[model samples]
Target chain A: MNRSALVSQAEPRDFIALLKPRVMSLVVFTALTGIVIAPGGVHPVLAAISLLCIAVGAGASGALNMWYDADIDALMGRTATRPIPAGRVTPGEALAFGLVLSVLSVLVLGLVANWLAAGLLAFTIFFYAVIYTMWLKRWTPQNIVIGGAAGAFPPMIGWAAVTGSVSLESLVLFLIIFIWTPPHFWALALIKSEDYARAGVPMLPVACGEAETRRQILLYTLVLAPVGMAPWFLGFAGLTYGVVAAAGGLGMIWLAIEIYRRREGAAARKASGRMFAFSILYLFALFAVLLVEQGILARIL
Target chain B: MAEQPTEAGIVLTPEEKRRQRQRNIAIALALAGLCVIFWIVTMVKGAAILQRPM
Candidate 1:
């Protein structure tokens, strides 16, 4: 095929891939939880709009991340097939797509929801694109630790969409994700240390050895276990949430311990993989329980 | 009358051209839906859209 023909062959799916749909799903879920948990009423349509904006904003962040990290992504096995790296979409296209979506998401959110939420959305795009992607990812082993705040903001932004202001409650939701990120990501980093090392990214495992990474993961999980139960203790969530959070937190800690113990061979990889997988479910179950308690159960009872 | 140079210098296969048409239609429909949403929001908010908060 000719050059222009090859360029013209870029499909809509390539654009979607730029969005990082999996990451966007997590953002959507957490943001929805925030919307449901916030102590107020929002029109269903407006709530839907707010969620759309959050999802699009998340997509924009992913696109920008891909644009910036295309080089490193090409180096990493796990990311070698991303749109930009695969040559299905150019970096310029991804940059323009991201910039357009970022502005559109923020503007529509400001008009439809509230400015506070929109501002938060804009800041999230900036934080992920500039601070995390451009700076921390290349510079520090604590990249995911500090960069996690960008992901954590969606819930707060969702909460602000309704309340027009941040509250202690919203901060609690933010804290849960912020604290949860390091251990969750570190587990994956342990499994993918070679990928990070190859890509020249200073992930904890790549920079500090696997043992230290495991130790930090255990420490973070220890802190997260209690904080995960905060919604229950704070009285916003019901007994269901408290029980689930406690159980899930223990499960996470157990998995982290397993990860810490099994550190030599395929057993270590399996343990790390299990911990990473379970961490996702742990967060999802915690949020799902909270959503049911605050949003559904509250409405019924 | 005229075929505009939207994909200038980029020749597309028939399948790509078909997909492009589909995408264009989808985008147009989405824009229309957005217009409807804007109308509904304006109607719902009414004076509040312009009102100053004290």
Candidate 2:
């Protein structure tokens, strides 16, 4: 009688990893900001349930992504040891797991929260699993640019889940995420060009060359900084989010400039890596300020 | 790195064939569970869309 005898096949770790648990932290946090900040109140239970649905929907997308990209995962050093690739779970098993979770999430959201959110959640899963993974990923260098819309939809969906409709304020959040995505992604691409090339993944650095990729990064950052401040201008968020977003935008541009000046070697890698790390923090801090601003506003109102 | 030559169009091995049978059964059971969940949810509430009636 070994302790693991009852559940010999269904390892907990594979299941947890399927959810892309690390990315879920940021997704959940930003989504919570969208939910709490949108004008109107959500029942505490409904809010919790909506967030749970969003989490499961995100996890479902990750599992489906792992399933679809199992071939690529086995090729690339970075992803070669994922659950499906490692034989911890078969690709078929991973697909089934993702499909089941996807449907369950939509149904749960529809019943527990609202259909608007359920529909958005359904679309997000489809966009990531099918649009990005199945189509855009292998087809073009514009993959991340367009595929980024899938990730950006969550904040807006979270807003609609609370307010029960889309609004200009929610669209501001969407714009920020959409604009922030390309520069954030290209920074990682600059360092991983060789890996992507070896894996036959046509990333920006490999497809367009380093100098061009760097220039695109700078251009996108230029656009993103102003977009990040949309909340401050619209009065959807407060002065705090505005100021912090401006500082983060400047930090992003500084890092992009450093990457632009440096060679595409260790120096550029370190600069791009710093930008990647700061990008995560930048998005989170901005959203956190939005949540705080909303809390203050609610107290005053 | 050489692109590994694989039997791309084929999805059937002895092991895969056996696994496919079990998978079909599993899928049926899962679909049944989903249908049950769907019914229960609808009984719990009406439509999910909270829209203004015009």
Candidate 3:
């Protein structure tokens, strides 16, 4: 590359892509649910600020992940088009962008919400960037298992923002996502074993073989089925959430069974892919149900 | 003066300049948004904004 081409030619959209907007959306949705479901409410403007800070914090972690994982990301077809890997943005720029946003998000969250929420946000950024991306991802197959806590913290942080403290209900929300992560991610890992191997990522299927990965997915799904319905059973949520959670739990189990049974050729890939897609819908439906119940239905009734 | 040379004596192409201008505008908008947020928070909290929880 010539020295003249070294000057950054990245567009604004490239900066947005660096934030992993899709993942940020999920974090914001789940965090918003936490805020809505909590006992007391926050000022509307303050709530918006809290959500913005949490979204930015999640985005910052994603940038740092992309910066650190650029090498391996380039090797994988799925992640190869990310800003740093695609050569639209340089690693130093991404790192600086991530660090700046991380600090600002934490600081602003503390000002608008509470230090507890801000502290959780900061820990989540550190856990994802330093612990999961830098260390656990390459070092162990259980990377997503532990690293999933980072994703789970958004709802807890949201709850903290509203109530200014953590509670059992918030921890239950955290647990649901934490337990759901293994089956959710391992399903995709099963389908992308070759890609994982190529990138040297040591994902479950690459490390433990497809048979064990499928078994682990089934085990985790079995656990998730019960945990997913806990909000209904524990009395925090109403009948609508119970029905949606029960149905989603059953769907997760059935899909896991299909993935476990079909272990040959395209059949295996299709089954894993179905599980991967359904897991996203299942989790989204659960949170969406909870959000509507607590946010709207509760108000009306 | 289509291509402006920086301190390193490296000149940016027209596309680079356009992108740089876009980035600069984005930064300006973001800073302005931050200021607005802070001001709104102050108004919402009134004198109570300074009394934060430990």
Q: Write the per-residue lDDT of candidate 3 for residues A160-212, one digit (tens) a residue.
A: 99999999999999999999999999998887788889999999889889899
> What TM-score fits each model?
0.93, 0.83, 0.97
Worst 10 residues of 1 chain A by lDDT: A1-10
Quote the positional error of residue A263 for candidate 3 in Å: 0.7
lDDT of each: 0.89, 0.80, 0.92
lDDT string for model 2 (A175-250, tens) is 8888888889888888777778887888898888988889998899989888898888887777778889899999
**Per-residue lDDT over B1-54 for candidate 2, one digit per residue giving the tens place of the 0 to 100 score:** 112334553334455456556656666875796577556545544564343221
lDDT of 2 at A292: 80
Cα displacement (angstroms), candidate 2, residue A206, comes to 1.3
Error of 2 at A82 (Å): 1.1
Better of 1 and 3 by TM-score: 3
| Candidate number of the best lDDT | 3
Tell me model 3's lDDT, rounded to 2 decimals: 0.92
Give the number of the best model, judged by DockQ.
Answer: 3
TM-score of predicted structure 3: 0.97
lDDT of candidate 1 over A1-301, digit per residue (tens): 4343244445677788899999999999999989988888988888888899999999999999999999999999999999888877778888998999999899878888888899999999999999999999999999999999999998899999988889988999999999999999999999888999999999999999999999999999999999999998998888988999999999999999998899899999999999999999999998898888898888788
